[model samples]
Target chain A: SQTIHQWPATLVQPVGSPLSLECTVEGTSNPNLYWYRQAAGRGLQLLFYSVGIGQISSEVPQNLSASRPQDRQFILSSKKLLLSDSGFYLCAWRAAASYEQYFGPGTRLTVT
Target chain B: AQSVAQPEDQVNVAEGNPLTVKCTYSVSGNPYLFWYVQYPNRGLQFLLKYITGDNLVKGSYGFEAEFNKSQTSFHLKKPSALVSDSALYFCAVRDIRGAGAGKSTFGDGTTLTVKP
Candidate 1:
């Protein structure tokens, strides 16, 4: 079975501070990875998606960016955090031939 | 562009009654629709998907969804509501031809409250 992991489960960052959230998938290779943010437990806003290593497509322009450094490792980063950047960040992966996506536990970010 | 609409912002249902969460979509070509459930502060859980074949599809935890092509709707349904079923529900749609690298368009989400 495949498992996805993200950390730290919760984060608190100061304004203008750097941010880094990691996501790694076990037991899958060359899967499609995605980054999304949910505000106040509402709808999911897609931020970025990567189909392969070094290939990332951003959906909406914002303070955050995503990278696929390895086949199973994806990272979401920001040079500086903003108060609006605070939300629950989710990482998901889907198989090349599959329609459904599997998600990680997610990281709750609070920028103060 | 693909879009999804969940008309109800919130739904209140008593336990043991049947439940339905409505979802309608618009997209070019065939649509790949999905239903997900999210508990408080947790990641979305994939409940079911409708790709093709049967209009009725069953999913985890006694959840099912029907795909109506003419109505352009995919409504999530359950035979019996449970108190544990209280959570947020989301409907998503993506064009079938968008298989390469397309992202799914998700609805604003509907909050389902199952009271005892």
Candidate 2:
């Protein structure tokens, strides 16, 4: 069975602080990875998605960026955090040939 | 482009009663629709999906959704509601042959509350 793992399950950082959230999938290779932020526990806003290593697509202009350094490893990063960046960050992975996405536990980041 | 609409922001249902969460979608090509459930402060869980099969799709936890092509709706239904069913529900659609091929557009979620 495939499983997704994310960390720093929870984080509290001051404004302008650096941010880095990691997501890794085990038991799958060459899967598509995605990063989404859910604010107010409502709708999810797609931030970035990667089809393969070194390939990243940004859904919207934002303070965050994503990278696929390895086939099953994806990282979401920001040079400086903003107050608006506070939310639950979810990382998901879908099979390269399929449409269903599996999600990780998510990181609750709070910017103070 | 593909888009989803969960018209209701909230739904209240009594336990043991039938429950329905409405969802509608738009896409330029054949759509692949999905339903997800989210508990408080947790990641979304894939409940079920409608690919290219029978309209009525059964999923985890006694939940099912009917795909109506003419109506462009995929409404989630449960014959009997449970208090544990209270959570946020999301509808998503992916246009297989459209511009945004790999990405699925999700609707603003609906909150379902099952009362005892």
Candidate 3:
């Protein structure tokens, strides 16, 4: 079975600080990876998606960026965090043959 | 562009009663609709999907949804509601027309509150 893992399940950071959230999927290769952010009581906003290594598509141009450094590893990063950047960040992966996406536990970011 | 609409922001249902969370969509081509459930402070979980065939699709935890092509709706339904079913439900749609076609557009999400 495939499993998605995300680190620093919860984080508290001050404004202008750097941000890094990691997501890794085991048991799958060449999967489509996505990054999404959900504000309180709002729908999910797709931030980035990657089809392959070194390929990233940004849905909404913002301070955040995503990278697929390895086939199974995806990272969401930001040089400087904004107060609006505070939200629940979720990472998801879908197999090339499947339409359904599997999500990780998610990282709750609070930028104070 | 593809989009999904969950008309109701929240739904209230009593335990043991039938429950329904409405969802409608708009897409340029054939659509792949899906339903996902999110518990408080948790990631979204895939509940069911309607790709083709069988308008009625059954999924985890005794949840089901019906796809109505004419209505452009895929409403999530459950015959018997449970208190545990209280959570946020999201509707998503994907248009099968281009590269990276599986990327989904999600609705604002409907909060299902099954009262005891």
Candidate 4:
């Protein structure tokens, strides 16, 4: 069975501080990875997706960026955090031949 | 561009009564539709999907959705509503492979409340 892991399940960052959220999939290779944000009581908004190492496609322009450094490792980063960046960040992965996606536990980011 | 719409902001249903959450989509060529559920402060859980084959797709937790090609709707249905069933439901659509990179467009989501 495949399992997705995200670190710092909850994060509190000061305004203008750097941000980093890490995700790793245990049992899949060459899977497509995605980054999503959800505002309070709102639906998910796609931020970025990566098809392979060093390949990333951004959906909406924002303060955040994503990278696929390794086949099973994806990282979401920002040089400086903004107040508007406070939300729940999710990392999901889907197999190449499958349309279904599996989401991670998620990280609750509160930028103060 | 591919998109999805969940018309209802919220749906309230009494326990033991059937419930339906409506979802519609617009996409070129064949579309791959999916339903996901999110509990409070939790990540989205996969409910069901309509990639191909049958129009009626059964998923986790006794939930099912019917795909109506003419109407362009995939409405989720349940035989009976349970208090635990109260959550946020999201509908997503993506164009078939070779069209795009398999990125899904999501709806605004509908909150379902099952009253006891």
DockQ head-to-head 1 vs 4, winner: 1
Local distance difference test, per candidate?
Answer: 0.94, 0.95, 0.94, 0.92
Q: Supply candidate 1's per-residue lDDT for A19.
A: 98
TM-score of 3: 0.98
Runs with alpha carbons beyond 4 Å of true place in candidate 3:
none
Q: What would the C-alpha RMSD of candidate 4 be, to one decimal place?
A: 1.1
Weakest 10 consecutive residues, lDDT, candidate 4 chain B? Answer: B97-106
Which segments of model 2 are wrong by more than 4 Å?
A: none
| TM-score to true structure, per model | 0.98, 0.98, 0.98, 0.97
lDDT of 2: 0.95
Task: Compute the lDDT of residue A35 as modeled in candidate 2.
Answer: 98
Ranking, lDDT, top scorer first = 2, 1, 3, 4
Which regions in candidate 4 have their CA more than 4 angstroms from the true location? B97-99
Candidate that scores best on DockQ: 1
Clashes of each: 0, 0, 0, 0
* Poorly placed runs, candidate 1 (over 4 Å): B98-101
**What's the ranking of the predictions by TM-score, best on top?**
2, 3, 1, 4
**Candidate 2 local lDDT, residue A110:** 99
lDDT of 3 by residue, B10-59 (tens): 99999999999999999989999999999988899999999999999999
- Model 2 CA lDDT for position B111: 96
